[model samples]
Target: MKKILFLTFAALLMVVSCKKDPLDQTPDGKITLEEVFTDKDRTEAYLSTAYSRIPDYFWKYSFFAFLAGITDEAKDSDVGNNAGNIASFWNTGSLSLSTNPLEAYGGQGKGISRYVTYWSGIRDCNVFLANIPKASVANEDYRKRFTAEAKVLRSFYYLELIKQFGGMPIVDKPFEVTFDYASLKRPTFQECVNFIVKNCDEAIAEPQFPLRITLETERGRFTKAVAYAIKSQALLYNASPLWNPTNDVAKWTASANASKEAIAALAATGQFALHPNYGNYFLNQSDLSPSPGDKETIFEINEASNGTFSVINSIPSKPGMFKAGSCPSQELVDAYDMQINPIAGGVAGEPAILGYSDADHLQPIINNSGPGPASGYARARPYVGRDPRFYATVWFNGAQYDNINGAIHTIETFQGGADQLIKNPPNRANTHTGYYLRKFIDPRIQSNQPHNSRWKKYRLAEIYLNLAEAENEANGPTAAAYAAVNVVRNRSQMPNLPVGLDKDQFRVRVRRERRVEFAMEEHRFWDVRRWKILDQTDKVVTGMEIIKDPITGAFTYNRFVTERRNAWTDKYLIFPIPLGEASIIPDFDLHQNPGW
Candidate 1:
């Protein structure tokens, strides 16, 4: 823990005064903070490095893993090394506050990569901001704009900390090497909110919030509205009970107003809007534009036509896209409403488990000659017939799973053919999530195809969810929540829900709608945390299974779920400060969360 913190602090320090290195320069070379910011190329490179450090593969911090697996968004019956534990704890809503297996909590070795890297960017930006004016060179405006951007990134990290662990320290500038650990104390939650808002103010006061398109140069880095959106998001979370369990009405109201102001201001920029089709939102490497009539997008961090084709890295690395991902959870599946509605078909009303005879052939019903169910299922009948997002989010039995061949493969509990997990492997092997994920990755993109397959880091969908949560809290949202939800729903060709529903009911629907709408985009776990609903759900280890009859007769009541199993606990929510760090800091509390 000390080593990690030490590294974090050291990184911050370097960010303070390090100068930019030329592209041809060695990775390890000395440049004071002054020498670096003077050069535009160097400045861009330094900031890009900050973004680059956001950890790839994300076996743990990958936004999707935690979002889908750690909340009630998804669950799997079979187990795998990393996936099952994520699914299990979330589905059960029973995670303990121990060292989170997800490593989502801050630590020396393990942590949200974005947390560390983004902070480093902030530190670097601070160094530039402080030194740019004093630089022997000119272009003061350029240096300050970059400095403003650093503030935006730093604020972004604080937002992450707030969402994951409530209140935390705000370190805007790089500290001297002599900064004392004993002096570091978490600020009041209000302080954190104010700090972020202040940063947003600085960002907005400057020429851009989300770069006014006019400033074309302010493209991806923090723009004026991006700051507002982020502040809005942060204040909204602050208003949430997770940050104020006691219902501090004043804090809640302030946060709502702050966020509302941001929303209105950002809308005024006239740069953002809703993308038409939800299906188009998931970019198929084959096509660049989104699906038709799906234009409800607001602000999005686009990965389109960008990167080294790294977005689809989660798919198996060899055949389709990459071997990095494909982890889906049944917990996620149950959340999607059957095309009909979340209330009617999705999990809200369905039985938790089902009973079936091993002899009952699902293939005959599904148009395949496959065996049937097991004698019994452990829990309750799984939920079904829900929202359209469910179909968009997962692959169920008889569902068409896309890939190179581009055929819809039926979802079945492992009827077991060797290599079924393979694309050409005749049999189907389910992912640890109990179902297959279909949101971010498009299976059709192949090495031979003229496309780049990868996950989108940001999209219009998340903003919609954010608006739903924020607007619902600020005002009894009628069109706000409905518009937000419809923005995403219509993307997938679904009908819009009626507007002006009850606040409580609308809140529930939107939350679930986000789960299905942005399944693998990595929103579920954080959504549950912000909504303060993790306590109400299960947190057990869930996994994948063959669901075969153990009896294995020609036809009998014999079926079983089989796969490597994993577990999650209550402590998993607020990651414990790794054991090593707790030992060194006398003031630090080892108050590991309950289940740890």
Candidate 2:
């Protein structure tokens, strides 16, 4: 009986030992957000999550949505004959709420989207802001600066959301797991803009925050200048015809003032200026320097480490080329004005108002008009004597494309030659427009080498154009506006606007200037939409059909309408809210844009 009692006591002891301990039950690898915020390193890494979510159209995810294709600027290689390619689908206006492209699922897949949803990014920003005070960063000033920067980021995400969807539910706090999604309602357009402005103001109010970043280590972070720039852009969009249908002159004045303020802030830094080479600027020539800052880039998506492979996608479809995507349109080519006699008051022979004609596009008829000291162009070369930017931006049939590693070869976009429909059939890898983009190309890039180029999100030139547009609208082409535009013109070796242009004439000049200066940089598509001129611009897309004679070796260029079916419509002014979200909401029409 004593032995049995001892065995029972041992069994009871084993049971007590095996009982669940609270410490043992805790998860090993998991960490609470509070723990994340309290640690300096963890908190900083957490802040980077917000930065990482910025829409990267140039890189891995949405490379095919080259904005040039959908606009008059250029045409993408016929990526799809059917409605399978995402870029083609986007260009064709086949978007639906159920099949929204908010993710990075490119092509006909399920991952790439057009960046319409940013709630997760917004949540990240809110989390950072709410928990930052709890972080134990020893540098008190830095903590304050970081807080202000977080505010700017929050504002930026809102700006992105508003620009795409007009307005969104302004969720300033992180939603709990049990939070009701159905109750969320999008704010008013004006309310959304005000919220963004308020965020900018909060960031600007921080005395410790700097106007520009001088440290190379912190290149892509938000700055006081960037905040102001965002404000300027948001205000400008608010004043634009699409959003401001009532023609509110006050909004224009506000936008002009905001832009001027941004310029003043940038100029105060004494580091910002126009880079001498417009073409080389986008190629990240500034990175070649050991210095921290670039004069041209106010804000940019920096890709210094891996470098961008956009060159590979954009290269002509020759034997050694990667893919003949991003083909420049004949319409964009024709927009480049051929240099003629720039007489003192106005161009000679042409009307004072109209700059150049089709005859100007041809070789000079006479010795005076033709290639000489007087005419500036040669007869054999049809592409010569155009704007200096034209040579930098386009690679035509006869132009020598420098392959830095080997001998320079003439780009053959003629019939039976390299990179033409006659020699290469029309497909995703072939050029539909018989022209290739030369802008943002690194001539030094060889087969094995990679290109590390900067993609400008905002720059001095764009700000100058913004200032000119806003000032022109507010004060009718004031001296400040003229000087602002002249800054961009002189940089590109183009002539200044003719001396006596009326408001309408000045407006036309400004619009054309914007088109040529910002071509293939993703501005034309949005510019048309905001200007309420998409109907005119998006009516038809054109391409150049080059017929080359085998015996004579002569080239005949004919322009033809390549893609029809007006992609522009009233519904497209603002993209529809993702249908997945709309269907779940009560009174779906109230939550969605008109007609899905």
RMSD of 2: 10.2
Off by over 4 Å in 2: 1-29, 59-65, 81-83, 101-117, 176-180, 285-293, 303-311, 314-319, 339-382, 421-425, 549-554
- For all candidates, the clash counts are 104, 9
**lDDT of every model, 2 decimals:** 0.48, 0.66
Which tens-of-lDDT digit does each residue in 400-432 have in candidate 1?
545434544444434452112321221122344
Worst 10 contiguous positions by lDDT, candidate 1: 360-369
- lDDT tens per residue, model 2, 247-340: 8989888888887887887754666778887777778734423344467776787544333353444545433555566778766776665555
Name the top lDDT candidate: 2
